[model samples]
Target: MKYVALFLIFLAAPALAQDDPAVAARAAAKALEQASEQLDDADSARDRVKALTTTVRAYEDGLSAMREGLRRVSLREMDLRADLAEREAEISDLLGALMTIGNSEAPVLALHPSGPTGTARAGMLLADVTPALATRATALKEDLKEVSDLRQLQQEAEQRLTEGLQGVQLARTELSQAIDSRTDLPRRFIEDPVRTAILIAGTDTLNDFAAGLGEITQDEEPGSLPAISDRKGYLELPVPGKILRGAGEEDAAGVERPGIVVGTRPRALVTTPTAATIRYVGPLLDYGLVTILEPQADLLFVLAGLDQVYGRIGQVLPAGSPVGLMGGEMPAADEGLSQSGEGGGAQWTETLYMEVREGDDPVDPLTWFSTDKG
Candidate 1:
């Protein structure tokens, strides 16, 4: 029976911890500190960029946790206020009764007890109850003090939330600045202004544009480029998200597209899964801003649906370099259907359309990245 009772107590501990706002706040703080340490320990520019992005995300998460803690504290304050009000009412009633009895005449007081013997018994009862009343008054005073302390805590939490939000904003600015400064990469291709202009003007669709790019010749063969073929099924995703559509999947327009769509958080940072040279970074038709990267002499990666592009054309970028940011809210893919309906609703704010091609042939991205389908 003792062991069973101990086991039950252990089982209930986690539930109690979950209810504690301070526990969540501490966890968020710890995560933020670890991310900051990673950012400080980063060796390469690419690693530093990723670390900075993670730190920014951690800061945002910490602020959210703090705000949740504040909310819980506010709720507790309300409960304390209600309890204090009830205690005050009880104290008022007790004081009113004492005043009424004190103002009564001696004869009236004796009559209230019925006779001499009854009056003496009543006095003895009052003597015993007076101590109990004093204890209740002391408890009420302590409750009032606790309510004051709770109000102070509530104020502190609100102030901390405000400061935390400002700190997160500052951290985001620093991350962006770090990415902008780290743009040095060994180039494998030279920009062909004439051919690029012709392709930009002639292409009617993304497929055509990709095909046109494939035909453009490189200036020199990059012997120093990393072997991307050897790293198949081991590449990390450019952004943290879930795969929404696979290669050759039918899109909302009922067209068979040759890319995967990933659903990510709004304004999420897009990074390179492997070392690559920037072939192009500009706006394309319907896909918003686009970035094209060549990981190898024969392999090209196309990324679209960006709100802003970071690197420039012909720039060499190492693996994990920041490429762009996901776009914000936009109109739905189809107009007649609700956003929640399949293919009819508003386009997701952070949907990344990625395509991997080897020598003009589209390849399944799932074969490259280790993704959790479940």
Candidate 2:
């Protein structure tokens, strides 16, 4: 009876089994750790804004991984619990059998009326059964232990999420300020405000305004930049997002444009996909804020719906240079807690309209840019 009591107590302690989620969690944590270290390194970087940009992007990647890992951890826990629940009756029966055996008299246990031959055979069978029973008990213990660890990981992740989210926001703010104070970039031509205003007032559509770019800035130059002809279908998106509406696809309002609609998270960083001259910047028509880049003669890349804009008209920007940020406020870290089982990919509610054109004619943006990556 004393031995059975000790065995039951051992069985009551939790253990472990499958480790797929733990593997993912550890990888995510590593990414977060690297990003955290990079955050510190960015402070002393010579190009402060550029370093901050990298830091923010790293944090984004880390947070994204952590969110996915947490989601997987939640699902794994749920599955183990469900499996254990289904085998509850079997576990109860096993425990009851052990109790019964422990309560029996030691001399009566395995004793048979057939004498020594029967007793020896019974003992041999008990040895084989005991190993199998112990194996099942160990497996159950591991499952319980895994469940406990998953729950603890989840609780601790909230604090990490809070720190990451706040860190990214601070990086973004610093990048914006750095950009404002920057005077290092060269300009191709100065924008004539009077002509720009006149063009805006006279134009009825984006096509009309874009067609008159020559009238707004007569000294515009894009010759030094290499032609993007070789880069056709290879250029990355200016922002990190998924294609919400493919080129020419209609939205819920049933209005379809030749351009694509990208779904992105709040305050996502926007960058130049390739070296290009900024032809136009600021609000245009109903589009919130727009940045028009000319990579080659007769080719234009237009991105609209920005919360903030960087660089001015005619400033040549290199590939991957920070251009702007997507609109919408970053959600509080606590707000993400309820999204435990739903990965970060599902959280994009903000939209950015991206378009491409040959002169004033609208064209399929996908033809010039690749969508194989985020």
Candidate 3:
């Protein structure tokens, strides 16, 4: 819906994505690449990563600010347009009044002379004079000037609105691309052997990362939970669906695993509460069309079983909004393929998997999400 403030109007219903951590990471990395491209100085890998992360965060902020500015500009333009319309109407009314005064049917004098015409000579003389004509001419000129000025103002406002709207749209597009880039960036930098080593480090690392994110504990029993602040709430499913799997399972019912899972009817929109940065938004093993949201550094939100992702990374969004709809689930055999970072572009026909990580460890998402009877 368009936001209406008094006479102003602004479009506020554009889709927002930016809820995945992978997207954020990619953006951060790309920003560094751009900077390095321009600079002659050599920087360490760690330094580049740090610089890129900061730049990505700045761009995310820029996207949010641009969206807001566009909204305001649109509203202003609407008001200006309305004003122009009123001015035009006023000019028309003035012209009508002048026409009425100049019409020949209405004689000016009430007194009728005893002539063949039954009209006073003085009255006839005055009606024929140009005094009334001069007055009407002056009024017309003034009204025309007013109309012209209003039109000029309207045009300027429209131009501003156009530019602002374009900026906002461009920022959105950039963020989306940045997210896609970031989700794949890690794969380029970290080879399979390194990633496998990272994965094998232990679930404790995953748990610690998840703990930092403040996601629901896998085992919230005594001595099992970690210390972390609660989020506003877990990312709510945009619509009804079923929870398919938790993160980091080697096998499910005699099948290999890749990412976690969530199953839904075809084309059901997925969403999270509030806006968040995207951690990863792409295809993964078993988790077809996956997206990961990092509400904060400590919390990671993963979404799978999407037909398409609506939002981009580094963009803010509201919870329970549509991230994407459900596609086919991943097959058990292909589940582990995601870990290998090889298989992609496969159509959905298997189970869905989802994960929530703080940093590296995968935490049980079931504790936070409402029960799925399916």
Candidate 4:
């Protein structure tokens, strides 16, 4: 009967040992799955900051879940440790009881129960309990071994969760930078003279022209030009006289002219257009202080023989802004005109030259205009 009881206790030990480690591992895996789902949802919607934040939160939650699992594992280990300790103490007590039960003096003492041998009676009970004590001690030692294995598992899970949190932080930083890059440029161009005519030309031709201008691409993409119904295209000066000269011309060469010589600036020549970006504020050659109105419609219109240059690079002006003072020293306005004749005069002519390059090939500006009479 004693041996049978000991055999049953040993049978129960293996079952208890199998349950704890399996339960902890399952709980940790479930927490990780939930965290992964949240990260995926944030990424799909294009909100990088939100996605990174979600990942961080998920990692935090995972850490909490892992810690909880560790806590449960630790508790389970403690329970096993306590059980082992209790069983050890119980085995010692049982051995004393079993020895007393199996003692040879036990049967002889039964006839003299009134004698002063109570301690001796207990000795026989300890002898009968001895085999049960040995079986319990071995079972409890196996339980202690399980607690050690569980402690190692908890440590490994903690280390992985720490690494996951760091990865989340790095992702958040990059997403913020990407968002700033997309929104940094101006929402609209503010009354820019150089870009306004380009916009009027329509989308396709403007894009083609802008592609050829390697330096201009750095600023902004050229937009479509607005359509004008009249097709007056650009206004031309009706009166023939020396108006302005461009930079490189036969007469203006080395003469320190402000603008390219097309015609000499007549003393009473009216202000037709404004200077664009004032590249050179001071007077140059036969031309007075010349300011190159940043080109419009692929035409670099020079306002030569100017007493003043009124605008800066980003400044916008209405038509006929005063650009320069009239003087004979300035280049003639009609110096380069094909129909007009060039003559020796302090009065210079200014003719508009259109260099319409598809890429590098210059096309005649005369063909692009609506009216040839200008």
Candidate 5:
């Protein structure tokens, strides 16, 4: 019965509200539900794209938390069952002893080999142990109840996970649609179609293409985008992810790039780190889809390898505006589980290639971006 203290190991689990997976799961569910409600009225919001983006991110976060909670519940339940099984013999003995003591007649229990003095001493001993025995019994009962509660929590979480998955999918679809139809951002200047085409056709490398970047637009009217030179080392990453490759780091092929590579979840949202004008938004050579943003004169932030490009060329976007989403579908239940802390399976597979240029000179992005900030 003392093994009831084994349940205390759960205290070391991740810090959730009250350190309970069920509570954390319920909180996640509430947030997910609220995001869903917002998604329903997204069309009525002043900035539908922003509202939908928030909803999509909320769903993503909620789903992630739910997955973690389910994992924790599973682990805790297995451990509790194992503890109970390992002490099965001890528990049986305790139960048997308690039963024997309960069923004995008071006169028989009172009888002692050493006479009245011995009997009175034995009675005093029993009274001393009663409180401890009752405490042990209570602890065991509580442990057993926790096991049952964990099982039920798992079932409820599975249903919530299903609903959360569906909700996120819908939110993503709406956000994509909203972005496609959006035409509210101001354009810095009109891009000259002929000049852009000529510039791309004459260039054989990224450097050459960037060298003639200014030639693509003839209007070149000064926009209202404020200078971000002071934000050089304070800008956040365009998306939530980990830096997989440092600037100029060699790959398996011994090739190096000037910018860092970030790996993130599939379909992760990408936003501008600072207010800038959209210099270019289209495919260029082997980089797949690309977006070139100019935050200041002669400076460019080039993001490549996007699945779908957002915003039109020459648009002046505010800081934190949605630029694009990474390629790939969200992992299904089985795959997602395998990607959690309890899992050793796959991880973030999508990568964003980023580079910063100062008038045709490729610069290291780490110096210009804050990789440690959210």
Candidate 6:
């Protein structure tokens, strides 16, 4: 559905080009406002939870759209800069030729000519060159104006990118706080201190940790949580963005993984796709700040690359419950590759690494989530 909406938007570009940017920004702001209103108007805890989810997702979508716009503007700025350079060179050459003509010995020729016919010929040549010089001057003036406009556009694009990034950060902070406030759900799984300690002590690899976690029995009643098997091909994405990598694909390190990587806005909300028990939440190996969730007795989902985690080990959370958030701003680099950012920068890219397993066997998550790439 998200892809369809975007495709429709693209198709209407010719009609929307004049006002699309302002309209899109306004629409995003309006969506956020409406979500907030809904949250306030909600009469029940369930309604409020839904409202909060909408609010977070709206903010994520808004930020994503703004970033995309800024990227397009950046590309346009690069093209404009190239054009400006070429135009400047042309203007410089034209000016040089004009200067050479202006400093010519035509005046001396007028005073001392070989004959009347020679003088008439020189006069005709001067008349012909005058219009050409005027034309070149006019072109030079237009090129100067164009260069100035390009500079202004570039400056505007940079300003928009900075503002968009700041807005995303603020929205993310608000979403995090809202998620933290919802603590009304009953605990379905109690933390096993002994098991947790043993798992932490004995496990050195992800597989080993997962195996240890699988051994721990859940205190929650069976059939209490929703069955993920029943919702195949209709699950919402844990985050609101496009999928970057499909299952069985090789990552930057050239290791083939049984999961999908999603490219999301910086500090985007990361939530549970279904009700699940938290098995682990911490940094592990190259996967920073990972969160492991078990949707069923045998099914496990792994989410990695979080800047901050929310739930604790053995806690049962409802579907769409906040797990954590994507990392904050990072240095600008190739977004396609998964590289951790050094510090918060004006523009950054984040990748959410996700994996699914059923009874220790890896499964393709693309077959589970809705096909909508919104």
Tens-place lDDT digits, model 1, residues 1-374 = 23223323323432111254445444655555565555555434455667776666665455445545545545555665765565464457655555555687756654434678888876666555556555555655665675676567556655555555455556556677776777545566677778878898898987678778745545745464667788988888887777888888798888888889998755666888888888788888877889988887767888889887887677788777778877663222122211122321222347898888877688887788889841
Off by over 4 Å in 2: 1-19, 99-107, 112-121, 218-224, 334-342
Better of 4 and 5 by lDDT: 5
Candidate 1 C-alpha error for residue 1, in Å: 28
Best by TM-score: 2
Q: In candidate 2, where is summed lDDT lowest over 10 consecutive residues?
A: 1-10
CA shift of 316, model 3, Å: 1.7
In the order shown, what is each candidate's alpha-carbon RMSD? 10.3, 4.5, 17.3, 32.0, 4.2, 11.6
- Give me the displacement of residue 335 in model 1, in angstroms: 28
Kindly list the per-residue Cα lDDT of model 3 for residues 1-374, writing each as its tens digit.
01012112111223222232223323433443443332222133334323333333333333223223323333333444555465565445445544654674564433465663656664564454435444545854653564455445434433433433343334334434443544322111112334333433433433332343222212222221133346333435434445455445556476543345655433333566445554445555444676767655456777666666765433444344345545543232112222222122232233445665645655666655555534
Model 3 residue 357 lDDT score: 61
Model 4 CA lDDT for position 28? 58
Over 17-87, each residue of candidate 2 has an lDDT whose tens digit, in order, gives 55687677667777777877877887788887778778888887877777777777777888888878876
TM-score of 5: 0.86
Query: What's the lDDT of the predicted structure labeled candidate 6?
Result: 0.64
Segments of candidate 4 deviating more than 4 angstroms: 1-26, 29-47, 91-142, 171-374
List per-prediction Cα lDDT, in the order shown: 0.65, 0.80, 0.42, 0.42, 0.78, 0.64
lDDT score, candidate 1, position 262: 91
Predicted candidate 3, C-alpha RMSD: 17.3
Residue 348 lDDT in model 1? 37
Alpha-carbon runs more than 4 Å astray in model 5: 1-18, 110-118, 334-347
91-164 per-residue lDDT for model 5 (tens digits): 67556656666899878877789999999987876666555555656766777998999888878777888888
